[model samples]
Target: MATLEELRKQLDTIDDQIVHLYEERMRVCEAVGEYKVQSGKKVYDQTREKAKLADVASKVSGEFNKKGVQELYEQLMSMSRKLQYRQLVQAGALGRLPFIEVDSLEKETARVVFQGTEGAYGQAAMKHYFGENCNCFHVHTFRDAMEAIEDGAADYAVLPIENSSAGSVVEMYDLLEEFENYIVGETIIPITHTLSGLPGAKLTDLKKIYSKGIALMQASHFLDEHADWQKISVVNTAVAAKKVLEENDPTQAAVCSAYAAQVYGLEVLADHINNEKDNYTRFIIVTNQKIFLKKATKISICFELPHESGSLYRILSHFIYNDLNMSRIESRPMEGKSWEYRFFVDFEGNLANPAVKNAIRGLREEARNLKILGNY
Candidate 1:
């Protein structure tokens, strides 16, 4: 066996050769990119890529070496594809995106709808985004809010899409995919849950606690401290407070926002019982039209992956190639399709941006049912 220092020296020499080869490969890829641009041909060629992968893998000896070489080349090719995509963008070869760009969201005279009753977090988010005096109404369910927008009963709808400590509002994601709503803007509100009850009710008098499922989970530590308390899921925390007051039961309390409790004429029994002190819930302003603001800096999209190996990696390569920063990614089971999932992704860029255009073009060509949810 060679000494450790001798092996290190040899490895360094091999790395130098690899770097030089990599530069040469990139130059060739750039030439190919130029050719494709001139020929008006598509950037992604799946048939050619598959053949290349197979040919390269066949040259390796052992199974381990074959797999390793294939993986390495997969990454290298993906990087090359990204470089080509960038070249196309710089050369003004990327085409227009599907979404219509708007100067601004209609807020002053627009009618808005929100899920849950008055004093709900959705209401607060709507007010925060659309000004305190904006025209808005409440709906009993998130679906109802979506329907309101779909029916043109409202210009926009405010709905929660995610929470900081408790993770995503998954139902909202499903609804977005199910409906034709487009997210135009997003707002984040700090969440501080409190246990509230009737004025004379004590902690000992509480038999059941009602709140949204996520809110209950966020306050799990505090609720767990009192194991005897029954937990009930409601539509929203504000709705739970409304129920507590309507029921007029001292035995029932609500785990809700302080504003909700106060608005519903309840007294706070405990304050800030959430697991994380800096918990926040992100709300999206959605509309029925497929429009985005011209100044929008973030985009959300969803797509279903083909049921084949390396499909996801191939799709993500578009983002890598365009140098787009993906902020969040989530997956939900595709409706009516067992064991198959649809993915939702949020990335930084506008629809009008060349890199964004390049990424979306490649993704639309490759992924199934690629939908641009919004640019905000």
Candidate 2:
């Protein structure tokens, strides 16, 4: 064995080399990342990474599987990206958060877009996140918001992901998987459902009611109390309120936000009509670039597992194994498949961590579809 002095010198030599190499590597990676981000290229480059792995493996000394080295390279690459992102952020290359500057976002005026009309929760969320002074637009469908952003019609889209009353929205989860965008921010709003109908209408006279899916689910108890009443499931609660007012359907009522009733000229039979008092819905703000980080509490991601009995379990186990808490998970049928599914998960950590990257790296080996929805 080498003497202690020799060992100490070698250790120092290795440490110095590591530091020097890391600095050198960062000098290049940081520049490239800045350019990639400015050019709107994706942060992670698998092909480039693969080519790097091949090049590095051809030169490394040990007989270990090149996968280990590739992992190391990936970790380094991720670290470099984070470093680069930090640099760009500090340089104001990436837009600021906690109040994005109107000019820096490259818009002459502030613009916000959400699914649904003026009285919808999406509109409330638009106001909540963007403030009342900002210009905002509404779309009839969730896909419309995505399409608008993709087609350069809007700068951002806000969509709901989960509700405290209902466990999870499967369609939204699947929509997240299908869409390509960055989750810029999150807004949690306390939902208060209003029972509104035509003026001078009695509760006993109500034979039908209209509401959005979540509001309907929330007000299910009230519906159950009136078993004889017909329920109408509309695309938006605001639409229901608007219809109730315009049609003046004496027999039909609507359960929606009070704002919807006010906007749609519907009379409120009762305010705060939800079965649960503490109802809240969490919405995700999606955009073309990473936007918010200061107030982020959750991160959403998706993974596709191989068709094996324990593949899903193995992948999920990593969350627990890493001591990372998962707030929610759902399996949706994959597109273009007869019996295949992709898993969408909301976890409680940022993707900027080494631990998170390592977990994703491990997961990527077993997954056919792996995507980081957004850090926020």
Candidate 3:
């Protein structure tokens, strides 16, 4: 065997040759892009790329090298496709997107809808986003809000999408697929749960607690202290507070926001009771129209991947090659497809950006049923 320094020198020399070959390969890819641009052909030639992967894998010696070479060629081909997409964009060959771009979202006069009753966190998020005095109504469930927007009963809907501590609101992701609503914006609100009861009720007076199921879970630490208290789940935290006030039961209290307690005429017996002090929930502003603002900087998209080895990795390479920053990803079971999933990804890039266009172009070709949920 060669000494360590001798092996390092040989590896460096091979790497230098690889670098030169990479540049030459990219130059050839540019020519291919030009030909496709003039011929009106798609950048992703699936048939050709599949053959190339198989050919490269066969040329390698062992099983490990075969898999490694295939993976390497997959990335190279993805980079070539992205380069082709960029060339198309530069030549004005990239077609218009399905979504319409608007200068701004209608805020002042637009009617808005949110789930839950007065003093709900959803209500607070809606108010903060659309302005405090914005015209808005309340519904009983998140699904109802989606329906309201779909039926044109409301111009917009505000619903929670995720929580920092508890993770994603899975129902929201499902609703996005079921409804035609598009997310135009989002807001984050700090969630500080309080244990409240009718005026003058003390913690020791409490025999039971009522709140949204998630709220009760979040305040588990505080509730664990009084394990004997019967914890009941309700539709909304505000609804729980309303029920406590309506019942006028001294032994009953609610886990809700301080605003909710105040709105329902309840005394906040305990404040900041949630296990996670810095807990926050992200809410999305959804509208019926498929429109995004001109300066929107983030996009939400969903796609189902084929059931094949390295499929997910190959699809994600488009984002990596284009230098797109993916902020979040969530997988939901695909309906009627057992053991398969559709992925929802949130990434940072405007629709008008060329790099974004390049990535989406490649992703759409490779991903099954790809949908751009919104760019905002």
| Candidate number achieving the greatest TM-score relative to the actual structure | 3
**After best superposition, candidate 2 residue 223: deviation in angstroms?**
2.8
Q: After superposition, how far is residue 299 of candidate 2 from its true place, in Å?
A: 2.4
Q: What's model 1's lDDT at 350?
A: 91
Q: Which is the winner by TM-score between candidate 1 and candidate 3?
A: 3
* Number of the candidate with higher lDDT, 1 or 3: 3
Q: Write the per-residue lDDT of candidate 3 for residues 97-122, one digit (tens) a residue.
A: 87898999989999999999999999
In the range 1-376, model 2's lDDT, one tens digit per residue, is 9999999999999999999998898889878867865786655565887698789887777758566786677568656655554454455444322223121243337567899887998899878877776777888888888777766778878889888878676777776767777776788999999899888888889998998877898988867888988888998899899888878778889998988888877778878878999999998878765454644556677988767555676577557655679987888887788688888888887555544554564455446778777766
Ranking by lDDT: 3, 1, 2
lDDT of residue 146 for candidate 1: 95
Consecutive 10-residue window with the lowest summed lDDT within model 2: 95-104
Task: State, as a TM-score between 0 and 1, how close model 1 is to the true structure.
Answer: 0.87
Query: How does candidate 3 score on lDDT?
Result: 0.92
**lDDT by residue for model 1 over 233-333, one digit each (tens)?**
99889989999999999999999999998899999999999988999999999999989998999999999997778888789878876789999999999
Clashes, model 3: 0
Question: Model 3, 326: alpha-carbon shift in Å?
Answer: 1.2
Cα TM-score per model: 0.87, 0.68, 0.94
